[model samples]
Target chain A: MKTNVKVLDCTIRDGGLVNNWDFDVDFVRDLYDSLNAAGVDYMEIGYKNSPKLVDTEGVGPWRFCEDDFIREVIPEKKNTKLSAIVDIGRVEVDDILPCEESSIDLIRVACYLKDIDKAIDLVEAFNKLGYETSINIMAVSNSLGLGLNEALKKVNESPVDMAYIVDSYGSLYNKDIQYLIETFKKYAPNKKLGIHTHNNLQMAFSNTIFSYEQGVEFLDTSIFGMGRGAGNCPTELILGYLNSTKYDVRPILRVIENRLLPLREKLEWGYNTAYAITGLFNEHPRSAIAIRKSNAKNNFLGFYDKLSSVETHEDIK
Target chain B: MKTNVKVLDCTIRDGGLVNNWDFDVDFVRDLYDSLNAAGVDYMEIGYKNSPKLVDTEGVGPWRFCEDDFIREVIPEKKNTKLSAIVDIGRVEVDDILPCEESSIDLIRVACYLKDIDKAIDLVEAFNKLGYETSINIMAVSNSLGLGLNEALKKVNESPVDMAYIVDSYGSLYNKDIQYLIETFKKYAPNKKLGIHTHNNLQMAFSNTIFSYEQGVEFLDTSIFGMGRGAGNCPTELILGYLNSTKYDVRPILRVIENRLLPLREKLEWGYNTAYAITGLFNEHPRSAIAIRKSNAKNNFLGFYDKLSSVETHEDIK
Candidate 1:
């Protein structure tokens, strides 16, 4: 029903955080073909982080989405475009090629509030290279009383094609989302809005739809909600909800059944109480992820107590 | 922050539909104690259906919810009250004891849109015997163009203390929730409202919270979302979100870790592609449930195709 809405499948990029970019080439090829057949607008192949800047010894090819690697995985570009994410200081502009010479069609810059200037600089560079660009502000839930207005104004003044509201901590509720969208619109009125969500409390899908209703044009989703900690909004859910003739959900469902479901045997993601606790406090999920790897994985009460004690200590300080 | 909102735990009642009421007495006792310690306002022990009306050979004691059975399980009543749900034709007035003579504090009648009259009769009977009463209209999404206005008006004129919006098929979105709340307010202005959701699309927690924001007084939840099919909103989520000193989430988290986690080995519930497909079509989950039981459990594409064929055939008709 919505013609302007664009769905970006970030299964390989966002889901990389879960498996350390260990996706097989066959799986990647299947996903690429399925997403194209499903009529998804864009597929974020992976990150474009420079290998020289970060440790990529054990990671897969997705950690550094070289243009040659992308072409090898997906030799032909279909209706779905290609995208890659880059964090500030993790990317080298020299490694990126002009849009006509590369498989990547869009380059998104992910950053925190403190790195807005650098993010805008990279987004401006990517835009100049003839690729669509977006600036994703991570952890906007913790941006309370921070200089979000100023950051949005800075982004608004840039050449960014889209500005994303990323719920990195997965702590936002409907009211917070409403407030953030209003703030974004007020300061960044010149830019299009996008929504990226995490499923720490099973609100990823709902909040994404709520954002769409409030005029967010771009939505970020992944296969089976495979991401760090609690995962992201599921691509199948968004495709099924869209129910447009342009999009076919059957292909998406097939890929999930064939590829993503088997990976669940070794990898763990989705909603858990430990992750929910961290999200409740608007904290990073690194602690929860660590505890899950430890023997106290199921000790949610202990996790809650630890968080409560930290809050108390902070208050005392 | 929300002092007037009441939380109801329906793990045994709604969850009974999944496992056929086969909960152990020890498990039930543990859940009861945990919910009470967690400061839940009410706990729906199970159904009060008459054995003469429905076949109950293999079912557990929860299907009956006899006063003696509840008393045996919970000898002492704490701050949390007890409630039971019954259907229109499956209950007999003589089977119910007076509030002062029984452990039950509330009696809720569940019905479809066409059975509003029968539901109100039961509510009136229960109210006359000094028990809190409510009327839950099931599958209201399918009640489109039905006489919902007439049904709500009839319930508004009854002795029912609460009116519920039950998304029986898990088919509602935010716009539908907003519209339903406004319609319920317009028709049943005097009755306090409650929400009971299904998580087929992973919207139960968000929808419940949205309803609360719109001033719905009573909230229905289950431990780890252990209901039929995709289950209800998780009780732990609401407790964490409420964050009032009156409610403690540690006990709920413990119950989930100890009791509900083990139940996952035998029972398959939660958001799956098959369930999401049925929810998107606004159809009952019987087909999805059946497919989940068959060899085609993971064949989401086949399931989607089957549903599509049926829809096409119906359109021809």
Candidate 2:
């Protein structure tokens, strides 16, 4: 129903955080083909971070996303463009080739509010290489007030193609999303807006739809909501919501049945009590993820009490 | 955060559809105590339908919700009130006792658009018996246009304390919810509004919150979303969103840890592709439910194609 909206499947990119970019080439190829058939605009394969800057002993090929490896996995690029994310310090300009020489189509820079300048610098380099670029401000819920306004102003002055309002904490409700959208549009009038949400309170799909209604151009989703902590919005849900003839839901359902469902048996990523607690407090999911890996994973009440105790301790200051 | 909002726990009433009301007495007692400690306003025990009218084979105690059994389960009343739902033709006038004599505080009549008159008749009878009454229009996504307006107008003239916008198909998005709330308000100005949603599209909790923002008062939830098919909104998520001192989420978490989590091992519920497909088509979950019971449960693509095939066949007519 929407003409300008572009759905980007970030299953490999965001889901990498949970399984450490361990997806095989066959699965990634299947996903690429399915996403292309489903008429999705972009497929964010994984991070494009430099291997020289960080250790990657056990990590999969996607963590660095070399052009040659990508060509080997996806020899034929379809309508779905390829994208890879780059954290501010982990990536270098020399690692990225010119867009005409590489299989990747877009390069996205993910950063916090404090690193907006750094993000813009990378976006500028990626733009110079003739690659589509975006600046994803992670954990925007914590970077509100004047700090966010200042960051948006900096991004507005950059050559980035788009700016993302990322709910990294998965803490925002509809009102918070609306307020952020308004603030981003006001401060960064030159940049297009995107929404990246986590399903901590089961608001990911709904909030993405709400954001679309409020004029966000790019919507980030993962197959079966596969990501870190509570996960991102499910790609199938968003595709179904689009309800346009341009996109097909059957391909997504096919991939889920053939690929993601089996992966679900070996990995766990979705809503639970621990993630919801962190989202409620507008905090990162590290503590919740830590507890989930421990023997006390099912101890939700104890987790709630511990969070509350920390809040009590903070109030004493 | 909201003073007029009333939280109602329908874990038993809605969840009974999944396991045929086979919950043990201790589980019900524990849930009652937990809901009370959680400061929930109302707890819908179960249906008050007459056993003589419908086949009660294999059904549990909740199908009938006998006053003596209710008193036995919950001997002392707490701050949380008790409620029961009844279908239009399944219940008899003589089956319900006076509110003062019975433990139930509210009697909700669930019916379709054609049965609104019958529902109002039941509500009037319950109101005359000194019990609070509500008219829950089932599958309201199918009852739009003039029928809904007429039903709400008829309900406006009744003694029913509240009227519910029930998304029985779980088909509605946020925009539909907002429009439905506006229409319900325009047609039933004298009655209070309630929201009951299913999680087929994973919009139950988010839609409930959106409905609250639109001035809907009564909020329906289930512990861990323990209803039939895709389930209802999780009680803990809404409680966490309210962030009010009047409610405590720890008790709900404790019950989920001890009871609901164990129950989840035996009963299959919550969001899945089959249910989401049914929701996308605005159809009843019967086909998806039947398929989930069949050997082809994991064949999501087949289910999606079957639904699509039906739509294409219907188009021929």
Candidate 3:
């Protein structure tokens, strides 16, 4: 409680990456209640992408996160703040209502460094609408030295309250995290720092702790590390580390037990060699994900050869 | 290839903690062949505990590691150095033949700080027999201030070739690893350093890298991090970091692919909340293992309470 650290339980939102955002409404609602009762600071329910901009069919209610649906699920929001992420160009400006008109309190915009200008515009739009906003720069492992400085400069000038150092590839080590955060501070010095880590190298929890130790405020986590590929750091580990009376780990654990544990069979979303290989090369995990779906799911060497045979930017590093 | 660091793959040895060392002979043989082909510096095939001192029933050949059995498996020993861990008081000294008479290249004694005297005695015995020796100080998280100084002193005076800072509970952070390695250097300055880490807080890879960065030469890893509780650092991750021609990552990947991946369903060994809770407290993972095997396996809160209810030295911290 005394600690300035804030836990954002993005179990539903980030986990959607692994399951195509197909969670049921009941699960999302219960997750909201559980996180609130757990004394977690925030709950990122899901993406706020416009259905018109992307296919909504077969996707869960959490994906669109219409104001009416969120209100219907949790008419009375409790201690936990409600939030959703919007991708650049994925959500129409009209899709975001004034914060006073909706239950959502925070609007997070996740985008690549190439679209930093657009992400900043969205952050400005949401900020003017009475909502706190954050900008997440994805795949920094690959984006470093490639318009990153300019993007960070642009993000620094924006009205974004928080700037997230997203480890989309899960390739960063301690030294790399230090270097990345220092660079982020050089430009976005005034903005609160957030850490969004993937567990490809099993460094997610440690990386999050490293972030907090370096004065980051927001920590993103998923239940049992349920997310795309290697998944995010587990909320349980984060809560356990914080060990604040203000944060109740029991509720987080209960949600994992009652709702998330059973999803393992279909999701297959924890740290594996495929993700580890991609992480090692500092490359995107799209190929690893493809390999996971193919007959060579467990064939690590085949995957390695397949990855090596391909000519790409990641191999140069 | 020229880093002077050594890789010790302990897939069969440490992995025995999960499946009661119930590995088939064919699989061990194939794994031995694979590690040799990979140019891995060392291959720890199994435990060298005396069968008479403990129960051998239901365990496999790896547990006892009979000299005749080892010779039969590796009829013509290749480039990989063969090693085995001997628990103090568990293994009969008469059982160990001279290094030249046996195929084993090294004899490692793993013990708690309280048993350091006994471990040193074993190390001396192994060294006298002309085999390189290392003393693995198990569960240093709980044993840090308790008898550690005395243990390190006795180990330093002993004829041990290497002194290992083992993180049995997988609770150590990079800073803690730094502290422990420095402590070992203080007492055992002349002895070569080694690191054996467990992955409870998901810091095994980072901790291992920290050890290497700190100049610890002997690094212990498993095929797929296949060990007790949260498992050891994966050999694949270690190889990925080394990225040298001396280490062929493909074979490690192949063993994991063709052999180890299939054992995952039967072995629920990896990072999980139960183990994470135990690790956070820097206590033994026996309670977590018990919780894992019980009905409340997925009940994180229940397991948390179960761990909290236990009043021991760990709670004081």
Interface RMSD of every candidate? 0.8, 0.6, 1.0
* TM-score of candidate 1 relative to the true fold: 0.97
DockQ for every model comes to 0.88, 0.90, 0.83
Residue B204 in candidate 2, Cα distance off native in Å: 0.2
Candidate 1 lDDT over B197-238, as tens digits, reads 999999999999999989998999999998988889999999
Count of clashes in candidate 3? 0
Q: Is the docking of candidate 3 incorrect, acceptable, medium or high quality?
A: high
> Would you estimate the TM-scores of all the predictions?
0.97, 0.98, 0.96
Candidate 1 segments exceeding 4 Å error: A312-317, B312-317
What is the Cα-based lDDT of residue B267 in candidate 2?
88
Alpha-carbon lDDT of model 2: 0.92
Sorted by DockQ (best first), the order is 2, 1, 3
The share of true interface contacts that also appear in candidate 1 amounts to 0.98
Ranking by TM-score: 2, 1, 3
- Where does the lowest 10-residue lDDT sum fall in candidate 3 chain A? A308-317
lDDT of 3 by residue, B4-80 (tens): 79999999998998999888888999998888888889999999999899898888888888899999988999899
Q: What is the lDDT of residue A260 in candidate 3?
A: 87
Per-residue lDDT tens digits for candidate 2, residues B1-317, read 76899999999999999999999999999999999999999999999999989899999999889999999999999999999999978998997899999999999999989988999999899999999999999888888899999989999999999999999989998889988999999999999999999999999999999998888999999999999899999999999988899999999999999999999999899998899999998888878888999999979989988887784322200
* Pairs in steric clash, model 3: none
Model 3 chain B scores worst on lDDT over the 10 consecutive residues at B308-317
Winner on TM-score (1 vs 2): 2
